[model samples]
Target chain A: MSLTADDVNKIAYLARLGIDTQDTESYAKDLSGMLDLVAQMSNINTDDVAPMAHPLDQVQRLRTDAVSETNNREAFQKIAPQVEAGLYLVPKVIE
Target chain B: MHTKTIAQLAKGLRAGDYSSQELTASYLARIKQHTELNSFITVTEEQALTVAKQADMALATGNAPLLTGIPIAHKDIFCTQGVKTSCGSKMLDNFIAPYNATVVEKLDTAGTVSLGKLNMDEFAMGSSNETSFYGAVHNPWASNTVPGGSSGGSAAAVAARLIPGATGTDTGGSIRQPAALCGITGLKPTYGRVSRFGMIAYASSLDQGGPMTQTAEDAALMLQAMAGFDAQDSTSVEREVPDYSAGLNNSLQGLKIGLPKEFFDDGLNNDMASCIETAINEYKKMGAEIIEVSMPNLKLAIPAYYVIAPAECSANLSRMDGVRFGHRCTDPVDLNDLYIRSRGEGFGTEVKRRILVGTYALSEGYYDAYYIKAQKIRRLISDDFKRALQEVDVIMGPVSPSPAFGIGEKTSDPIEMYLADIYTIAINLAGLPAMSIPAGFIDNKPIGLQIIGNYFAEDKLLNVAHQYQQVTDWHQQTPQGFA
Candidate 1:
């Protein structure tokens, strides 16, 4: 499956990336190259094999249901792009 | 001081031959002298001296361990509290980590003085350091040549003797490829061997932290402290980490080494293949047995890894959206603009390319065709390793297809660069332990011999590498001008 400029632009949008129009053409080419490379998987018959998601093949370990973490809002917010009153502030969403 | 290995330095400190302060200071001077290599992204001088003095106190008290007072650098992927953990990207240029990664905290307990965070490919993507936002790391052997990545800076720093050792992460061939190109020893342990609590996520299943050092013995010391179970990291293994340093002198008699038929098939460089044969002959003389093994599914490692890694990265990096931490756009129209522009300006071309690929693979319509199929093929690739390891003690092959290439050699074409990791990526796909040790050279550029072992077989891999070093001096051959 080859990716066109529109397909790449949609991918960039889904990825929340602002890909410039000029780079989209190049991206389409590169993405198609990658797609062509991965298309070989279709030839291999993995019909009975289970998809291995994790290496260890174990579920995530459960922990106690309690407040284990300390309050580090001040420390955490220090690196925030914009923080006000210990809250991360972003551009207005609600109209 | 600059020429000594980690073991020699530790012995010197124990015998009162030199203080940790003197060693740290000497290394700091060398790091400054070799600034042209662009190995270091940040050098924590004041903190290094402070830690060095503390190590000296421990030495004076006669309570120092093997790594006490030794100066080392960390790949920026491991977050260091109070330091700018850039991961070699502009996205985190101003982001100071709020806490230390498990690896960093373990090193602190070992009393290793940190030089600073080293450079890496942006978010540990890319086959060469060319993708690093800071700049490409220059090969110590040749300035115009590239050091392999994403552990390029770590390999270059250790290779140049700026520091005795460093920490590196391998999601694919990151650690071993760079180590091979720079003529050092780098070990990528079993997937869950080292805790990933604080290390930045790349491909979560494949990413692992390990040691980059001058010798296998030194790598053992570093890996000893770095491996363990962590409650914070849900995926960390719950097993005992044996004394890796204790088994370095083990005998190699009757050790069955599998020579993968797939590794030598077309695409390997001629001189590099010769060097691999020489190294294999060395092992034969050491009383080891060599057998040919065919891994028919190994050819699919590249495609499987490219798909699986990016898919995970797309999800992992989604958290970097502008609101919480890291780079943010200026005067965004709204939330969508903030994310789009911040990511656009923040990520490099290679990183963006991967994110786009990953997003498409994991998207609604193509999920089964790309993402799930890759995962199924991942199982086939791993099963081949299981079968091969059953016949031999370890698998032997070239770490990279060739010696270090020129800086801009393959950067223009992504496929060409991706093939550079052909031999090394299969190990990470299987989540097994593997290492790269300097074997020989091609036209003065270093080549590496890759040793791969079954799950949690780090000791056996290090033992074989250590025995090889005992017979050869390739790891000791430094870059001419730097020496």
Candidate 2:
């Protein structure tokens, strides 16, 4: 798939990256090259092959349904960009 | 003291040759001398020394274990209880881990001193250390060239003698490739051999933490401490992990080594080929037999990895939304704005590109065409390894197509960067154990011989690497000017 200018723009928007119009051509070119390289898989004859998701075929073992973390709220919130009243603060949505 | 292996250091500490405080200070001093390499993201001198002092006290009381007081560096991806685990991205620049990863707990119980967090590619995405948010790690071999990433810092530190050993995680080729570039020994054990409870996810299925050191024996010593089943990591295997260092001198006589035909194709550099050939010949002299093996699906590994890794990364990173921990945006009009702006400002170019590609591949109409297809191809790659391993005890190949490339050589072209990982990605895709042993030098730059083995065959891989190292001085040779 060749990426159109509009497609590149949409992808950038969805990815939350700010790409100016001038950079679109190069971005499209690069993304196209990467896509072209990745497109090689389409030619392989994997018709009878079952998809392998995990390296091992074993089922995932379950851990006890218990909280492994403690109440380190004060320490945890220290890295937040913006916080108030021990809660992470964001812009008002319903206003 | 600076050049001693981890085992040697541990033995010396045990024999009262030096106190833990003295050993830790020597490493700290070496780290201070090699700041230009940019191997470390942070140096926990105060914490390390305090721990070392306690270790010294324990030694006096005759209560010290093998790892007690040995200073080691951790890749920035492993979460520490209070240390900032950045994963080389500004996205988590201020984020401190609330709990210790299981590996961290194990090491702490062994009494290993925490040197600090090492630098890496952002979210373990890049093949070169240039993508790190902190700075690029210089290959100790050639200052202008890149150390392979995203575990470049760990490899660099060990190569430069700044640290005897360090921990690194491999998703695609992070550990092995960097180890190759830096002329050190690095191992990526079978998928579930080591617990991943505290490791920040890249591609969950492919990620496994291993050791980087100057020799395979040092890697073994470190791996002995790092491996084991952990109830915290659901994927952690419940098998018994043998003492990896116990068989370092094991006979390589009659051991069958497979040279994958695909790995030596046109893309491989002549110098790298010659270096690997020399290493193989050295192994032949040591009584190991070499056989040519074929893995036709090897070519598809890169493409399959690109799809699966990004698809998983997209899902894993979604939890980094501004509403949770990590970097968040300033005042926002709503939660959506908060997430969008925070992510926009947080992630680097390569990371954002991956997230976009991953999201698109998994999107409504493209899921089967991309993600599902990649999964099917992934199986074929694993089967290829299985068939080859049945014929040979271990496989040997070039860790990378060439030695370390110049910084900015392939950064502009992401495809080139992806291709740089061609030789190493298949082992990760297959989820088997592999290691990069310092084979020889190509034009003053180091080349690595990749030793791959069957699942849970870490001991065998280390044995082969250790046997080869015993017969060759490549692991002992140091880069000029630095030495």
Candidate 3:
């Protein structure tokens, strides 16, 4: 149930988060500790129980496909780190 | 003027005893004077004064709302139009919300003056306010002690009389834990009771907005304004919003209070047990019959919660990538580099730890073992509450394991910090309405008596807390220097 340095790196990569190389061992220890805590759930047999996603057991209420929001592109993009012509700019992926 | 409750302030404003402008000024001055508490992240003084003047004009017409001109602040988690809504994270430190959260808008509609945004744990993650990027909020009772948090600023500010009341959100024990630590009243309404539109999401299923105030009466007033259905938030409940203050004076005669035996075991502090017991004794005198109930699944709450909350947080926080808004890295070689470095630089240690854990838990080959397993345990914990509440009107217990710990006491150990929420976390898992009221103090630190009720039982919980407040003066007791 314990995580290793390799597991920590794999998790960081999957999460798309950068972790300092020197901190991997410590992160491994912390993550493993959490796994140990979470491991306690094994004591109970929940094979017959249905997984509850919502607290009230209510399903998502769907609505008609009508447009309910107005375009506020200018206002919305005002806080972006980089934007031009109503487009959010990120690193070039296709290139 | 600063010591007056929201009810008293509202009455005075209407009766011409003091203008809303004067009250706003007084609270603004107090907030400025207590800079050491680090309770507020932003103070909207100019906006508050302008709004107070307008409130004064509305009051003159004799038809203003009950909360008219009352100065209050919001937890930084709520998006406030044109105001910085940090959620106490460096990622959003520079972000100004384009629109108001439904809670903020509703409060404004009720004519409550906005004092500004209070600090919180970064993205509402930690139990202690120390996780906040702005800095740890000092407990009003003891400056060296930690103010219980993610809603630490709201609790501390209200306790220090910086603001009469403020909004707080509880994902885990954010609202009630801090309220108990700071010796104030805080309520976490049932899931979806209050609209979550524009409220920065942490754990969507578990997070709920409520009032952190000096008394249950004030919390009722705040909840009356904050609770309702919103088209903007799909999860918003469509139930009727009852007059929360209407049942404040209701008799507790024949009220059945269920006490979970597990909460009173050796884990509870001796002083906290006595204080909570004394509070229950007062309820007994008022004709409440206490029944000891056993909820075996309660111990699994923390483990399950850690999994579910972090899993949700990881998905929700993924939107904080470098492109659209929030922090972006100075330079990036590629898209992956942009996301990885931006998130790594923006988020704090605890937040990163959670995201990684969530990533691992939901990854291939482990989703059922960790995520689904936690969900099943969540149902078991919730069912335990259902069984207990079926037999009693409400459940009463300690709000926190103990009073406020020293600022650095448990910071080195995350597990210890998580365990501190043991008494309060189960209620959130069940999505039940619950409250923490000032029961008494131990070693000058506050202890809160938690009153948990069935779903959408906000009125009942408020009534129970209000009746208790009527007989006790603990909620009235302010920290010495602040008073």
Candidate 4:
């Protein structure tokens, strides 16, 4: 149930929360505490039970394939972090 | 004027006792007075007065709806157009919602004036309201005690008479826990009962919005306008919205009540247990039969909830990638740094911890071991509720283990804070309707008697709460200073 420093780094990387050497120890302790909490469930055998994905057995609802909403790109992009020329500007990925 | 319930206010508004503008002013003044409570994030005074003037005009023409001109403080979780819907997190601190959430739009259409945004836990994560980036909301009953949260601000404001009624979203007892501690009435309708179109996502499977008010009748009136089907929300149930106000006077004769044995174990506070026992006896005297029920799987609810909620939240919050909308770190060398720092800087400790845990649970190798195991136990918990519900009309229990605790009491330990919701989370897993009504007080703080019912049984739940409220005066008792 204990998470190692390496394990903590992997989790931090997966979750996309910046973690350095100092914070990793505390993160390890906190996460290990939680992992121990969930580890108890593993003891009770759930061999035949189906995993409950949702409270209700709902189908994936579909609507007619047609454009319903008017274009509000200008309104939506106004809140973006960095947008220019009607496009979101993210960090350089390819270049 | 501030102490009047929504029902009374609606009546007075129609009778021309006062205009919506006058009532709106009173609430605004009190919001200014109770700055120490930290209950509100933004008081939209100018917008409220403008809406109130329109409501007054509507009421004068004798063409007003049920809740026309009543003032309501909305939870900051909902997206109110042109207002800051922070959800008590720095991630969305700069987020000024461009469009109104469905709850906001529906309430506005009914002519209820918006008093502004109420505070909440950071992304509805904390049991105590202390997780808010805006600062923790103080319990109205005691200045130093924490108001039971996620909906802490909504409950505190209503108890302090800052607003007669307010809207709160309960992911895992957010609405009910605060309502209990603050000596107010709150309802969390069956999952999918209310539209979640624009309500900020916490755990998509468990989130449901309902009313937090002084009386069950007021809750009914507010809920009538709030519940409905929407094309926007994928999980919104397509059903007829009953007249919740009409069922308030239904007789409680021969009502069957089940008290879950698991809820009253050795961990329960003695004082809170006594108060709940007294409330149950009151129900028995009102011609309701009480029976002992067993929900063996209820013990696993907290663990299962923590796992399921965090996992869902991890997926849901992935939308906040700094590029779209929210706080972005300065001078990012690459997208990875942008994602990491923006989220790291934006979220608080508890939020980050949950995100990390969720990512671990949902990651490649551990998915089957943790996430699937919790989901399986979730089925057992749901089955337990389904079985117990068949034997009884409703299940009764404590909304929380004890009344409101000191603000910093459980802040250092997340597990202790999570255990506070041990009595309440299973209902969300079962997707049933439940409520916390003011039962009594423990050491000057309030305790709520929780009534849980089967799916789509909100009408019956509200009826029972209203009947109990009729016989007891607990819901009528306001905090000393506030009164």
Q: Which ten residues in a row have the lowest lDDT in candidate 2 chain B?
A: B329-338
Going through the candidates in order, their DockQ values are: 0.86, 0.61, 0.86, 0.82
Second chain TM-score for model 4: 0.99
Q: Please list the C-alpha lDDT of all candidates, in the order they appear.
A: 0.93, 0.88, 0.93, 0.91
Candidate 1's TM-score: 0.99
Give the higher-DockQ candidate: 3 or 4: 3
TM-score of chain B of each: 0.99, 0.98, 0.99, 0.99
lDDT per residue as tens, model 1, B245-286: 889999999999999998998888789889999999999999
Query: What is the full ranking by DockQ, best candidate first?
Result: 3, 1, 4, 2
Fill in the DockQ of model 1.
Answer: 0.86
lDDT of 4 by residue, A1-95 (tens): 89998998888888888776788888888888887777778778899999987778777689999999989898889888989999999899997
Off by over 4 Å in 1: none
Name the better of 1 and 2 by TM-score: 1
lDDT of 2 at B68: 87
As a TM-score, model 3 comes out at 0.99
Pairs of residues clashing in candidate 3: none
RMSD of 4: 1.0
Clashes of each: 0, 1, 0, 0
Would you list the clashing residue pairs of candidate 4? none
Against the true structure, candidate 2 reaches a TM-score of 0.97
TM-score of chain A of each: 0.94, 0.84, 0.94, 0.91
